[model samples]
Target: MSFETIRQVKKFTMTSDERLFALINATRYILDKKIDGSFVECGVWKGGSMMSVAYTLVERQVTKRQLYLFDTFDGMSEPTDKDYDIFGSLAKKLLQKNKKQEKSSIWCYSPLEEVQQNLSQTKYPTENIIYVQGKVEETIPETLPNKIALLRLDTDWYESTKHELVHLFPKLVQGGVLIIDDYGHWQGCRKAVDEYFEQNNISILLNRIDYTGRIGIKV
Candidate 1:
């Protein structure tokens, strides 16, 4: 895969949704420059977006760039009432649904195996893609290598978002793109980013990619 091929994939996957296009373009831009370091997604559900990044990298013939995908493969962890407030009613609905499901039913949460299988179906070489399975706190340290050129955070909760920022942000290469998939869509996520940046005494350079999303490049 070369830069041209990556451009083709972006063109094919283009959507009216500006956030989606920003994601594709971000991945393409990173690969086209042959950026140093690896690519990582702190919260990959079903590997949809990360797969986009991987496919683009492969298409661009990017070598020596590892793609690390991190996830619990299970649903969100337990949340307190305060956390629940940030998540809104969806959390309650999800909890209710979980209680109603049969223990033996396959209607459970996504597993790491399923995500890996999906990636394999892409026919991209397995050599460059690495799967890190576990909770964000436990998995992020292990997933992040020495340097990261592109870091995508899609964990849609307060705890997970904060954990990733604290543990993973320092590893990001200067000028690296940090894409937050749940930024403005979820209140808890928005609060997490705000609090994290505040505590660090650093201000995030937010670029509203769409009504529900934002991305920032590390200075």
Candidate 2:
């Protein structure tokens, strides 16, 4: 996308929350440090934040890094206890029954096609952004190519967060930024981060952005 296009998008676009904008600026600053790696977001919902990052990169004329987006294109996978305990036993039982009734009950969520269509309307070049579609567990292992400079994890489920942390954390660069979107909002996500960091013997300094989000910069 060109500078003019970026300005236009910024003009009519719905601005992100203050904390989100701060996080984006932090990401851009980290990317500006001449890091020898790429950018990636594990769970992109409607491509808003990721698109904003892409546009910022374009506006700054930063062309060396690739922006990779990984998502199921579907909302989320089946709720696992590691993430959905508060939903109550009845809700769990209902979900179980639904699962028994339908083999792909979770597939009812939005697909990647809609997200792609929305991106098509933007000036972000398709060449710079790579969309990897599939459940994180099934797609991440095969999709992540090299060390990442920026790793954003927005998966709300405990299993999903844990899976990504295990499979994708090692790929993050030394100075990479790891942004967890659901860190403070969802109990399951917080659990996953806490457990994973403990198990791996790695201490991350989490900088809480807001009530719903927290970020950790890998050093």
Candidate 3:
């Protein structure tokens, strides 16, 4: 996809242009290789990234793979001490704010309805699009496809990120790609991914997508 075309995909997502380009290219690679599985995204804030996947499918006229979107639609779930930014301030503030009052994170409070509408407006096949609304820790195992062609995770917390990799990563087929949106930017996200690899004794080259994003092809 051209950078101009990817810019259009960026409209519905908060992801940087380079990350979106990576996502688009990954989708294209999956299709070109005829990987057998569906596309999955763990955090669908505004549904932009997944929309890009859908857009690519439409542009390529490949209509069989399903797109699974999972999120807490209301906003971010409480971040544990393990979940913190690189400087370790953002998560602490969020933790403090949680204690003072029950409030969702303002940054990711995109509602399910709004996200649905954003994606539906794309005119992608409605039946092929599935939205699982809840914390990924709870919803992923129950709702994720049995097979996945591409798994893009942006949940940016320790427990949630770890939970996703444990459950979903195994389902990603050979030659499929695993994209971690916050692997480099968020400490907790990075920790979870590294620990998952260590615990499983798996080693794969993670291609850099800017400073914060990473793409690992499942060998």
Candidate 4:
């Protein structure tokens, strides 16, 4: 996967290069192990990581699982009371650029159409991919995949992360992988993860995929 193709993702995607590499590596492992169940991503900004998942599946001609891309496409929601401590402080410290609060608040509110275009233009199997556009708290309740093989959580707020973990973790299949993109990158997200796992008594070995990326394979 020299990705003579990485350039395309890098050129247009918003995530850091290291993060992209980590996502691809993790996606490849799912394919290599032939993990059963569908693929899912809670934060699909620009669809970069999601694109890699599509590309890898196509490259391997994997047609059994559908890829679910969930996002508001509108960017990050207002930091919840629980999230205010961290994200609120950060937002207050930084000057909002373009007078856009989403950019400075916690994460970006991306456009659904643009991301759809990126994946469509890249020739991903649009037919098998599902897009859920709305706030995670509202949009995640119904129609979630019955089983998830690789669950990627990228939302940067504690409330958002907490909701995803609460709703999706139970559905994650045994031997499936859970990747947290903000474990080391964002304080609110890290706290939510740590608290949730500890409270739930989930003791899966947490491994660092990179500086900001982490993974836990369900046993």
Candidate 5:
């Protein structure tokens, strides 16, 4: 797909173009490798990243697999002390803005309906799309797919990121793709991933995509 076309998808996402491109390629990679399972994204704010996956499936004329999107759809949840660095400052700012605005002014306040509308506009098969609206800590296990071909995590907090990995990573088929959107940018996210890997004895080398993004295949 042309960069211009990807830019259109980027409008619905907070991801950089480079990260978006990596997502597209990962979508295609799973398909090309004939990996069996669904595409899952945790922390789908506006649904742009998943939309890119949907677009890639359509562009490839393959639409059999399900697309699962999980989110709170009301901006970010509160970050704990474990979540520090840029993410911590940004969260504090958003909280202050919320108090001043007094109108739930949290970052990534995308409603489920709005996200549905955006994905529906892409001509991707609506039946193939699944939206789980709630905290990952609450909704993941019950709603997660049995097998995941591609797993993308962008929650940017320690607890949520850890929750996602604990529940979802096991379901990822051996050779499945895992993309972390905030590994280099958020201390909490990086800590969660590193801790998960350490606890699980996972030694996969995460390939860098720009400064914040990292991708690795499960062996």
Candidate 6:
């Protein structure tokens, strides 16, 4: 599905226009440069962003690179105090926007079965997509590709995000793109990423795709 078609189809969870642009551009970079690696998503909820990558790859006929989906499939691990803080604020805003949402939690709550169902709904071929069902700390380390062309992460909490960066970032090929989906919006996510860079003394520039998303090109 093209971007315009994706816009028209709103059944999937929310992904901002700017975020999609980053995905498309990163996909273009990998395909055009013939980046030798696969695409991976550390946290996929209902397969929205994951399918977006699959759609673009299929559209461009970039079939060699597989797309990996990593998640616990059951909500998140236990939320810490910081996670509670973020969830509390987000819940209030969500309740104000849609009273119906007050009934239950949103994201990461989707089970592995549902994620597979969601992927089956997309036009993209699933043959090149790999689904690893488990927590980031476990699945990411064990399932990392030999090289990563595009690594997009949306894992909401601190531990999960940091685990992903620790295990997978090094596998990112030089010139590969690493996109962080909840960078500016979620404190836990931001702290994990910022701390990783700081601890490593990594100087890769973070280029903003939008208020909520940022990308760094591995060099």
Q: Highest lDDT: which candidate?
A: 5
lDDT of 2 at 73: 74
Candidate 6 ranges beyond 4 A from true positions: 8-10, 84-104
Model 3 C-alpha lDDT per residue in residues 59-120, reported as the tens digit of each score: 89877779999998877777787877766667757655653322234357787888889888
Alpha-carbon RMSD, each predicted model:
4.8, 5.4, 2.8, 2.8, 2.4, 3.6
lDDT of each: 0.69, 0.69, 0.85, 0.77, 0.86, 0.75
lDDT of 6 by residue, 38-142 (tens): 899987767777776766776787666788999877755644444423444642343244432221354346777777887776556778779998877766677
Candidate 5 segments whose C-alpha is farther than 4 A from its true place: 86-90, 98-106
Q: What TM-score number comes out for model 5?
A: 0.93
- Model 1 vs. true fold: TM: 0.81
> Residue 19 error for model 1, in Å?
2.9
Tens-place lDDT digits, model 1, residues 53-168: 66665666664678898877775565434343333655445556654233322222467777788677556778888888778877766656898888888776788888898988
Tens-digit lDDT track of model 5 for 1-219: 747558778678778888999888888889889999999999887788988888888889998889999998877878877776554564555455564323224457788898999999778888989999888898979997889999999988999999999999999999899999999888889999999999999888899998999999999
TM-score against native, each model? 0.81, 0.80, 0.92, 0.88, 0.93, 0.85
Lowest summed lDDT window (length 10), candidate 1: 99-108
lDDT per residue for candidate 4 within 158-196, as digits (tens), equals 888999999998998888889898787677888899999
Ranking by TM-score: 5, 3, 4, 6, 1, 2
lDDT of 5 at 195: 98
lDDT of candidate 2 over 1-219, digit per residue (tens)? 334444434422222364457556656767677666778887776666666676667667675567787887755566666554343342244455553323244323446776676666656677867899988988878877587877788767788889999988898888788888877666788899999999999988988777767777787
Backbone clashes, candidate 3: 0
Candidate 6 TM-score versus the reference: 0.85
lDDT, candidate 6, residue 11? 52
